[model samples]
Target chain A: MARTLRSALLLAPSAVLIGIFLIGLVRLIASSVLFDGQIDLHHYVDIMNRPDYIAMLGRTLRTAALTTFFCLLLGYPTAYYVARYQGNRNILLLLIIFPWLVSIVVRSYGWVVILGPRGLVNGFLMWTGMADRPLKLMYNDFGVVMGLVHVLLPFMIIAILSVLMQISRNLEEASMSLGGHPFYSFRTVLLPLSLPGILTGVTLVYLMSTGAIVTPLLLGGLGDTMIGTEIFQEVMHFFDYPKAAALATVLLVTAMAVVLPLQFLERWLSKRLTDGAPS
Target chain B: MIQTPHIPIASIVETQNLARDNTPAEPILSIDHVTKRFDGATAVSSVCIDIMQGEFVTLLGPSGCGKSTLLRMIAGFETPTHGRILMRGEDMSHRPAYDREIGLVFQNLALFPHMNVFDNVAFGLRARGRTDGLKAKVQDMLALVGLDGFDDRRTGQISGGQRQRVALARSLVTQPDVLLLDEPLSALDLKLRRQLQTELKRIQQETGITFVFVTHDQEEALSMSDRIAVMNAGRVEQFGSAVDTYHRPATEFVARFVGETNLLRGQVQAASGGRVTLKLDNVNATVTVPAGDSSLGLGTDVAISIRPEHMTLGTGTDQPIAATVLSHSFSGATITYALDSAAGRLLAQVPFQPGGGHPLPAKASVSVGWADTAVTLIPGKPGHSQSDMEN
Candidate 1:
C-alpha cells in the first residue's frame, strides 16, 4: 500500500502537467468548433467546400508520400553500410543526429539561403554555366521535399541500422553454406527481418512531413501552400477562432487516419519478424 | 546385364575403388607437411596426417594445441600456409569451406535459430540443388538420429541432447563426404555426453562416412574413436588405437596425456628391437616400446612408463619394487593407494576384497611389482599422474 502511494507520488508531477495541457487544448478546440450559444458545423463544411483547402490537402499528402519513399530508398544503403563497417559507429551516428539538435525553424531558415533564387545553389549553377539564369528553385514542391527529407532521413537510417545490426551474421553464413549467394542471402533473410524497422521509419517520415509547418512557411511559395501551413495562417492571422479550430480538428483527424493504420502495420510486422527468434 | 541396371554391394564397392585410383591411391584426405602460422607466429608446425574413407578419426588434444585448427583446415575453414591439402589426390589447400561438401558442427552447433528442425535438416539439401524428395530424405535422416516427429518443433524448444541430434541430422542430410565434429558433445552434461557418445558411434557405423571429431577430453576421444590421434603443440604426438595409445605410448607427452601414468626418469643401459633397458637412480627395469624411434644408444637418457593398475602390492621379494604408502582412497569396487617410491608418488589400483583392501599400515614396509611388459619406455623426465577414471 505504501509502495503504491510512492509510485503515485512519483507520477504526480507528469500527470498534472499532462492533465492541464490536455484541458487547455480541449477548451481551445471546443471554442473553435462552437460559438454564439449554438453548435455550428459551418466552419468544417466550408473547409471541405473550399477549392484551396482541398488543393492544399492533396499537395501535402502527395509530397509527404514522395518524401518518405525517397528517404527509405536512400537510407537503406547508408544504414546497411554503417552496420557492416567495423569502426566509428558512434561518430557516424553523432554526425547524422547533429542536425536534430538545431531547431526546425533554424533549419528551415538555413535552407532558405540554400534554395532561394540567389542562394548558393543558383550561384553555383550560374558560375559553372550549368544554367544561363537564376533557377526558380525556391517556394516549390521540390524545395519543400528536399528540406523535409534532409531533416527526417536520419530517423529512417538509424532505425533500420539498429535492427540490421542485431541480426546475426551467422544467418547469412548459413544461407551461403546452404547454397545461397550474397544477394539472395540479403533478399531472403536480412530484408524480411528488417521490414519492421523500415516501416517504423516510413511512418515517422510520413507523420512529420504531413503536419510539417515551419519548413513550408519559409521555403515554399504561395503556389505550394500545404494544409498545415494553411491551418497556421487561419489561427494566427484571423481572430475567428471557431473556423480555425474547426480546420485544425479536420487536419488532426486526417493525419491520424493515415498514421494510425500504418503504425499498426509496422507493429504487426515487427512481431512477425521477431517471432522466429529463440525466446 | 544392362536390362535393369542392378548391381551387387560387392560390385558397387569394387566400382568405387576402380574409379578412386585415377590419379593414384592417395589418401581420401591428407594433411601434408602442414604448418599453420598466425600473424608470423607458429600455431601448428610441421604436422602431417592422412584420413582414409569411412574412418572415425579423432583429433584429441588439450586446449590451444592446434587440434581445432587442424580440424578446421580439414573442413576448409582455414588454409595451411606452408603445406598441401590433398583430397582424392587433388590439391585443396585453398578451397572455400562451402565447396568442400564437408559439414562442420561448430563448438556452438551454429544451428539456425529462425529455422525449425525439418527446415534445418533440409538446408544443406536445398543448397546442394536437390528439389524433389527433400522432405522424405529429411524425415529419414531425422528418424536415423532418433528425432522423428520433431519436424515442426523449433531448434530452441528441444533439449540440449535433442538439439545435438538435430544438428547431426542437418549436417548428414547434405551427404557430406567427411563430417567434422568440433566438440559437439562438450556442451552437454556428463550423463548426456556418455549417452550421445554411444549414439554417435552407432550413427557412424550406420552411415559409413568419415567422422573426424575434435575434443580436448581424453576419455571422450578414447571411448568413441576407432583411432585416436593425440596432439600437442599443433602436431600429432601419437596416433593409434586406444589400447595401443594407453599401453604402448610412443612419446612422453602421449604417456602423460592418454591415461594415468607413472613416469620414471632413467638412462638407457640397453636398447633392442621393441625393448629398452633403463637404469634409474634407485631401480633398474626393462621396458617394451612400440616400434618407431630406436635411435637411443647405451647411456642415452630415457624414461620408463608404468601404468598405475599395472603395479601390484606383494610381500615376496623376487626383484620386487619397494615404496611407502602415503595415502589410500576407497573407490567402492577398487582401492587406489598412493605410494611414495624411489621414482616419485605413484598410484596403484587394487581390487577391493569382500570386506576391504589389505590396508598396508601407514608408512609400513610394502613392496610393489610389475612384469617387464607393463613398463613402457618414454623419452622425458619423471612426472606424477594424478588422473582418475572413477568418474
Candidate 2:
C-alpha cells in the first residue's frame, strides 16, 4: 500500500498534465464528429477522399524514409570510427554532438544560407567552371531532406556508437582468426550485434522525420508541404479545429501503420539472428 | 638450432591431405627473439621459444608479466615489435590473423552470442568455404567437448563450462595445426576447472594438435602443460617440463612464482670435492649446493630455494634446523605446518595419514631437515640478516 501510494505521488504531476491534454483531445474529437451540435463524420470522409491529402501522406512517408536511409548511410561510418578510436574518443564524441548546442531553428536557417541559390555550393560550382549558372539548390525536397538529415544524423551515430563500443574487440579478432576477412567479420559479427541500436536509430529518425515541421517549412516550398503544414494551416490560418483534429488522427494512424510493423519486424529478425531460427 | 621450415600449399589443402596421412615435424611454432611494445611500454621483451608439434606448452605467469602478450603474438593477433615468428618454418610475423591458420580459444571464450552452438562450431569451416560435411563436423566437435545435445542453444543460454566447451569445439572443429588457449578455464570454479583441465588434455592428445595455453595459476600449468614457460616481468624465467620447473627452477622468480618455496640467503663457504657448501647467513647451518651449477663460487652471496614438501621432520645426518610450529592445517591428504626457526618462518607440507607418528601442534618445537639436492642456489644481493625468505 505504501509503495502504491509512493508511485501514485511520483506519477501525479505527469498524469495531471496528460489528463488535461487528453480531455482537450477528447473535446476536439467530439467536435470533429459533431457539425454544429449534430453528429457527423464529414471531415474524416472528406479527408479520406481528398487526393491532395492522400498525396501529402505518401510524400511525407517517402521523405521520412529517404531521410532515414541517408542518415544511416552517413552515420554508420562516423559512428564506427568514433567508437573504435583509441585516443581522444571523448573529443570526437563531443564534436559529434556539437551541432545540437545551437538552437534547432537557428541551425535550419543556417542551412538556408549554405544551400540557397546564391549559396557556397553554387558559387563554388560556377567559380570552378562546373556549371554555367546557379543550380536550384533550395526550396525543394532535396533542401528539406538535407536539413532534416543534418538535424537527425547525430541520433543515429550516437545510438550505433554506444552499441559498437560495447561490442568486444575479441569477437572480431576471433572471426579473423577463424579465417574471416575484415569485411566478412564485420558483416557476420559487428553488424548483427549492432542491429538493436540500428533499429532504435531508424525508428527514432523515422518518427521524428514523419512529424517534422521546421526544416520542411523553412527550406521546402509549395509542393513539399507535409501533414504538419496542412494541420498547422487548418488550426492557425483557417481556424478549422475539426479538420485539424481529423488530419492529426489520420497522420497518427499512418505513423502507427508504418512504425508498428517495423518494430515487430525488427524484433522478429533479431530473434532469428540471435536465437538461430528456433531449429 | 633453427629447424628447417616448410610451407603447405594452403591450410585447407593440408587439411585434406592430412585426412589420409598424418605426420608432424619439429617445432611447429617458433618465436625467435620476439618483442612487443604498446604505446612505448614494453609488454613482452625479447623472448625465444620453440613449441613442438603436439606438445602442450603453457606460458604461465602473474598478471602483466607478458604471458598473454606472448600468446597473442603467437596467435597472430599481435605484431611483434622485434624478432620473427615462424610456423612450419615459414615467416608468419607480419601475416594477418586469418592467414596464420592457428585456432584460438579466447580468455572470455568469445563464442558468438548471436550464434547457436552448431553455427558457432561451424563458423570457421564456413569461413574457409568448406561446408560439404560441416554439419557432421560440428556435431562431432560438440560430442568431443561433451556438449552434444546443446546444438540449438545460444551461447548465453549455456553455463560457463558449457561456453568453454563451445569455444574449444569452435576452435578445434577447424582442425588448425595449433590451438592457443588464453586462460579459457580461468572463469570456472575449482572443481569445473580441474574437470576441464583433464578434458582439455584428453582433447589435445586425441587431436594431436599443438596447444599453447596461458595462465597465472601455477597448479594448472604444472598439471596440464607438457612444458611450462614460467614468465616474470616480460621475460621467461624458466622453460622446462613441469617436474624440471618444479624441481630445478632456474631463477628465484620461477622458484617463487611456480610454487611455494622456502628461500635461504647464504654465502659459498667452500667449493671442492665436487660439492659446494653454503654457510647460511643467520642460522648456524650449512647447505651443499646442487651439482653442476657453475654460477656459484667462493664467498658468493646466494639465495637457496627449496620446495616446502622437500623439508622433512626429524634430524638427519646433515644439520637439523630447529623450528617451532606456529600453525598447521590438515587439507585431507596433506598437512601444511607453518614453522618459525631462529632465521625466519617457513612452510612444510607432510603426508596426513591418520594417527601418524608426527603430532606437532602450534607452538611446539621441531627440527626440519632437507637433502642437498633439494636446494637450488640463485645469485642474491647481500646484507640481509635473516636467512629464510617467504613470498
Candidate 3:
C-alpha cells in the first residue's frame, strides 16, 4: 500500500498536467459541436463540404508523405555510417542533432535564405551559365518539403542509429564467414534487423510533418496551404474558434487514420522479428 | 633441445604404411612461422604447425596467450604479420574471410537471433546460392547436431546447448575445408560442456572435417583433441599428443600450466652414460633420471617437475621424505593433500573410496615418496616462481 501511494504521489504532477490538457481538448470539442447552447454538427459539415479544404487536406497528406520518404532515403545511410563509425561516434551524432537544438522556426528561416529566389543555388547556377533566370525555389511545395525534411531528419537518423547499435557486429561477421558477400550479408542480416527503427522514424517524421504550421506558412505559397495553415487562418484571421476546432479535430483523425495502420505494422513486424529472442 | 616433427603418432603410422605404396600425404594446412602483432605488441610470435586432414588439433593456453589469435589467423579472420599460411600448398596469406572456405564457430555461438533454427542453419547455403536441395541439407545437418524437429523455434527459444549445435550446423552445411571452433563451449555449465565436448568430437570424426579448436582448459583439450599445442606468452611452447604433453611437458611454463606439479630446484651431482643423479635442495635426497637432453651436465642447475598424482603417501616401505599435512580438499573422486615437507610445499593426490572413512586429520605427520621415473627433469632453470605462475 505504501509503495502504491509513493508511485501515485510521484505520478501526480504529470497526471495533473495531462488532465488540464484533456479538459482543454474537451472544451474545444464542445465549442466545435455547441453553438447558442444547442449542440450541432454544422462546423464539421462545413469542413467536409468545402472542396478547397479537401484539396488542402490532400496536399497536406502528400507533403507529409513526401517528407517522410525523403527523410528515410537520406537518413538510412547516414545513420548506418554513424552507427558503424569506429572513432568518437558521439561527435557525429552530436553534429546530426545540432540543427535540432536550434528553434524549428529559426531553422526554417535558414532554409528559406539558402533556397530563396536569389539564393546560393540560383546564384551559382546563373553565374555558371547553367540558367539565365533565378530559380523559383521558395514559396512553393518544394520549399515547404525541403524545409520540413531538413528540420525533421535528425529524428529519423537517431531512431535508426539506436536500433542499429543494438545489433551485434558478430552477426555480420558470421554471415561473411559463411561465404556471404558483403552486400548480401547486409541485405539478409542487417536490413531486416533494422526494420523496427525504420518504421519508428517514418511514423515520427510523417506525423510531425502533417501538423507542421511554421515551416509551411513561412515557405509555402497560396497553392501550398496545408490543414495546419487553414486551422491557423480560421482562428487568427476570422476569429472562428468553432471552425478551427473542427479543423483541428479533422487533422487529428486524419493523422490517426494514416498512423494507426503504421503503428499496427510496427508492432506486428517487431513481434515477428524479435518474439522469444533474448534481450 | 631437439624439436620433434609435427606429425601425430597415428598419422606417422599411416604415413609409414602409405610410404610402401605411394608418396606420403601432404599436410592439409600449414601455419608457417606465423606471427601477429597488434599495435606493436606481439599476440602470436613465430608459431608454426602442420595439421593433417581430419585431425582434431587444439591450441590450448590461458587467456591472452595468443591461442585465439593463431586460430583466427588460420580461419582467415586475421592475417599474420610475418609468415604465410598455406592451405593445400597454396599460400592464402591475404585472402579475405568470405573468400576463404573456412567455417568458424565463435566463442559466443553468434547464432542469428532473428532467424529460426531452420533458417539459421540454411543461411550459408542460401547465401552461397546453393539453393538446390537446401531444405534436405539443412535438416540433415541439424539432425547431425541432434537438433532435429526444431526448425521453427527461434534461437532465443532454445537452450544454450541447442544454440551451439545450430551454430555448428550452420557452419558445417556448406562443407568448408576446415572448421575452426573458438572456445564455443565455454559458456555452458560443467556438465553441458563435457557433454558437448564429446558431441563435438563425434561430429568432427563423423564428417572427417579437420577441426582447429582453441581452448584454455587443459582437461578439455586433453579429453577432446588428438594433438594439443600448449602456448604461452605468444609462443607455442609444446605441441604433441595428449599423453605426451601430460607425461612430458617441454618447458617449465608448460610443466606449471598444463597440470598441478611440485617443482624442486636441483643440480646434477653426477653424470654417467645416459643417467644423471641430481642433488635436490633442502630435501637431502638424490634422484637419478635419464639424461634426455644435452643440456644436463655435471653441476648444471635444473628444476624437476613431479605431478601431484605421481607422489604417494603412507607407502610405509619407501617413505623417503617426512612431512606434516597442511590441509586437504575433497573433490569427489580424489582427495588432494597439501603437505609442508622438507622439500618445500608439495601436493599429493590420493584416491578416495566413497563411504570408506574420513581423510587424515589436519597437521598429521606423513611420509611421501615417488619413483625415479616419476620425476621429469625440466630442460631449463625455472623462469618464474610458483606464485607468479599460479594461474
Question: TM-score for chain A of every candidate model?
Answer: 0.86, 0.90, 0.92
Docking quality (DockQ) of candidate 1: 0.23
Best by DockQ: 2
Candidate 3's DockQ is 0.35
- The positional error of residue B324 in candidate 2, measured at the CA in angstroms, is 4.4
Which candidate ranks first by TM-score, i.e. highest? 2
Among all candidates shown, the one with the greatest lDDT: 3
lDDT of 2 by residue, A1-279 (tens): 999999999999999999999998788778789887898999999988989898888888898999999999999999999987979999998998999999889999998889887888888998899998988887888988899999999999998888998898899999988988888788788888999888888988998998888888888877769888788888899998989988887887788898899889888987777765221
Q: lDDT per residue, candidate 3, B50-149, as tens digits?
A: 8877788999999999999988888777899999998867787898778777898999988887789988888887777777777777887888899999
Q: Estimate, for each residue in B121-201, the C-alpha lDDT of model 1 and write its tens digit.
A: 877766655646777778878998999999989878999999999889888776566788989999799999999999999
- Candidate 2: C-alpha lDDT: 0.83
- Candidates ranked by DockQ: 2, 3, 1
- Estimate every model's Cα lDDT from 0 to 1: 0.77, 0.83, 0.84
lDDT of 3 by residue, A88-166 (tens): 9989988998997899889988877788878888889999999999888989999999999999999999999999999
Span of ten consecutive residues with least summed lDDT in model 2 chain B:
B382-391
Output the better candidate (1/2) by lDDT. Answer: 2
i-RMSD of model 3 (Å, 1 decimal): 4.9
Error of 2 at B101 (Å): 1.7
After the best TM-score superposition of candidate 1, give how far the Cα of residue A275 lies from its true spot, in angstroms: 10
Over the stretch B1-391, how does candidate 2's per-residue lDDT look in tens digits?
Answer: 1121222224434443464255445468888888899999998878888887778999989999899998888888889999999987889999998887799999998888888889888888877776766677788778888998898897888889989999999998777878999999888899999999999999887777779999999999999999988887788778889998898877778788878998887888888876788888788888776645555668888788889888887644345588889998878888889999876889999888787766577888788877777877666553222211111
